[model samples]
Target: MTHHLAPAPLLALTLPSEDVLYAALLARDPAFDGRAYVGVTSTGIFCRLTCPARKPLRANCRFFSSPADCLAAGFRACLRCHPLAPEAAADPCIAALTSALEADPARRWREADVAGLGFDPSTVRRSFRRQFGMTFLEMARQRRLREGMATLAAGGRVIEAQFDAGFDSPAAFRAAFARLLGAAPAEMKGALLQADWIDTPIGPMIAVADKRSLHLLEFADRKALPAELARLRKMAGGIGLGRPQPIDQMADELGAFFAGTSARFDTPLALHGSAFTRAVWEILRQIPPGTTRSYGDIARDMGCPEAARAVARANGANQIALVIPCHRVIGADGALTGYGGGLWRKQRLIELERGYALRHDRQPDDIGQRADGGEAGQP
Candidate 1:
């Protein structure tokens, strides 16, 4: 299937025309690194315009102003270009505020609330715009919309959801819902696949599943999350809020994994992707929690030595997070690189997994790697 990145918002965000952005991308011009990002329709990945990796065809490229825009349109940050780096994550103030916002995505924010946190609201706005190309309040409002929709999806009354999401009124709530997910709040819920909000040490996660397997698992604050939820709803007929057996099992397994007690995730997954992508995910599963692999390493294991970029694309495409262990993949030069969940969470996950490796007596060379280049047995 041919996937096209959404064009309207991308066009609106850039002052430069698509032709100019395409030219910059071809030239790999550093001048447009932060100002413009290129989303590849074929690979479902977005990269900095100046990324050193191979460029996609002009027809396949969509330009966005920020990583948040790229992900909200359902494109994963490119592993090779580290598009999500030097991101809001690199700013200590933004990082600290976003962390709090992530933990309580349902909470409403105001200038007072921000000042209460010891940050100047004006400074926060400028910093967020500088790094993420949007204001911190804008990001927070997006979270509120997700939380409200999640409530409605989970079977809450519209008024109940409105209040739960801290909105001023039902009209405001419904309007925000329509703007964010392109549907009225009442039209968002269904009964086929069940959705639930799960909390982790890193942050909250949304798990969508049926009776048998997990269909989607992602961080709640992920820019792509709202889009992913909408896609699942359309594909599965409808998704309601409820805890299925698989989700319960997953919650337990995740608890153990994050606590450094176990690395095994036996929660049956509904892996979505092409055959090649599935093969890459399987290799990621074999990577044992405490070890890491480069994209080149994964491609070599798949017997496609020249498909390193493809492997990175597939790695970024994974939505199931920890259960699939995409965090175990890193740059060839031993960098943390980019992560859809933000690099801070990636770093923490690696640190947590290292303890799991140590308990099993399989210490890694740097963080989650084996120096001698031999795969260790599963924990």
Candidate 2:
């Protein structure tokens, strides 16, 4: 079996300016929890942004991007935040429970089931609530709703969908359908796309797809992801969160890519964009793995050399991450440019591909070539 090695951990040595990270720490923003760690010089401990402890003064707070960085700087993990613990999605216990839920979304989960899995009910409840903003039971309910919706979307009869969703009676299923979806099962419109979350080496990603093609694949931390989802929902008529066939295929391909066993993506994609944007994305897919092309090069290939900026805009608008290979686009000078997933991730991806190319005796792209015609290696 090919093991998917995790992405390089975030480290303070490569983080943004101290002032920027300090501000995020002051806000206690949950979005920055795994992306950064706050080290308090006075206490010699580092904590996640979501830590419940009182915030230290700006002068006393030093920021690191990973627990390893904090340890390297002679700081211990804060007991309050348990900074050394794996992220919620990566936690072995949480991962096991989530897998089980995916396998049987309609199964009624109980406190006894949690204990039977060798976990305390209260502890599991708190973990689920904190990580997902809902109890495990609530998540199961939503999963059932999505599964039922998927069945309906696939043209199954109302009775079939209700039973398939594990509902005991049509009345119970109809009540839930109306309460959550604002419509009765018979009156509801079929969803054009289904959404689901997949855990990756970098982070958890949200995948949205129709029956035939993948529509979106983006890191969950992207600031613009919500807006992208809203746009997709409008275009697709309705988008529900659940496992779809395309999502499972994408998860497998992603696992293979991260494991360095393969870079090819066979999952079909639904390109929703202007003609020019679609054309640009198609060119992106043509660029082989371990190789890159600049915006100018893409524009030239499209017979519009002056449209480089427009091409760059289309590249940025790409919703699909690794599969579409937008990270393969670089500056004219061979430097990495703006990436919504963060520059650190862009850098890491380039390095990962370059290493793979070297190991396989493939000719790597020109990312290492400086404007002055010298090798600069990884950016």
Candidate 3:
């Protein structure tokens, strides 16, 4: 049988060729699980390759490989079959624990404490670090620091902010903030800076945007953020560091979003990524908040279906989270796959959209605080 190597143009994004699709399927890689799909255009229905549903003939079945592809081809998401949800959960225990930690960043979490939560300390430690690139305890500490920053921005006294943030002492809080943001609490005041706090279902997110665009969006204490901001400072010639205002406009819109009142992200964005990664990020923005597509679908839409793995890699490289709408992309089986913001966040984001009539794009740099700190896991 001749294998079709070209991607079907009906999808929103590109996808891999038939040979590559079959290989990914045969290998049962959970990574590519939701990025591809097979459509029996003859039957006017599409199904995930991993779908337990009966398999159709390879010839009669046209492979669209992405939810957008299937939709573009005039096929609707199967009501009896959902292909947007990922089949396999990526490290479920770690995901749950991370969600718990984010929810309660004020609570001190020790390895022994985590062990008492019915998870193996070593496994939990390795899983969180591998998935998020930071230890659970480290994430907690960062969260406390972010809370301190937010509190200070809200006009609270240093001591009040420090204690409320769960800091052991004023000195410790100041040191931690200085180490991470290069400014002491008192030094962070003044200037045209404005600050505000917004809460998502997962946790609180902080956004700093100027009048024209958003500069940073992040959870309260995400680990990657302090470093990212340092980079932004160098890029902007040290303009919006400890001082705010540059990111004020974005903060308002972000607040509306998490409040379940709005989903439109009109703020201009500064995305830092390679050309291919940039393209993927752009497509991610086009995905509506409530809707979803797969990475394979994105690849096909980009006219490079055979580059599904490469597309997935680019998705992983995406920095801005919800604003870019990367979370809307699911595995082939309609399951949540990789999300740097954590699957729990992804799930809650979906739920929030649904509850509020669901509308949803790329988060700007440092888009929100992590509530807890560290690298966002893969998208």
lDDT of 1: 0.70
Model 2, position 125: C-alpha lDDT score: 83
Task: Name the best candidate (by TM-score).
Answer: 1
**Candidate 2 clashing pairs, residues 3+ apart or interchain:** none
In the range 132-185, model 1's lDDT, one tens digit per residue, is 445788878867766666667667788888887889878988887666544576
Give the Å shift of residue 10 in candidate 1.
40
How much is 192 displaced in model 3, in angstroms? 3.2
lDDT of each: 0.70, 0.69, 0.60
Candidate 2 lDDT score at position 20: 65
A best-first ranking of the candidates according to their lDDT comes to 1, 2, 3
Please provide TM-scores, in order, for all candidate models, with all chains considered together: 0.64, 0.50, 0.55
103-162: candidate 2 lDDT, tens digit per residue? 877897877887899987787888776555567776677677666777876778888889
- Between candidates 1 and 3, name the one with more favorable TM-score: 1
Candidate 3 TM-score, true structure as reference: 0.55
TM-score of 1: 0.64
Q: Could you tell me which 10 consecutive residues in candidate 3 have the lowest summed lDDT?
A: 370-379
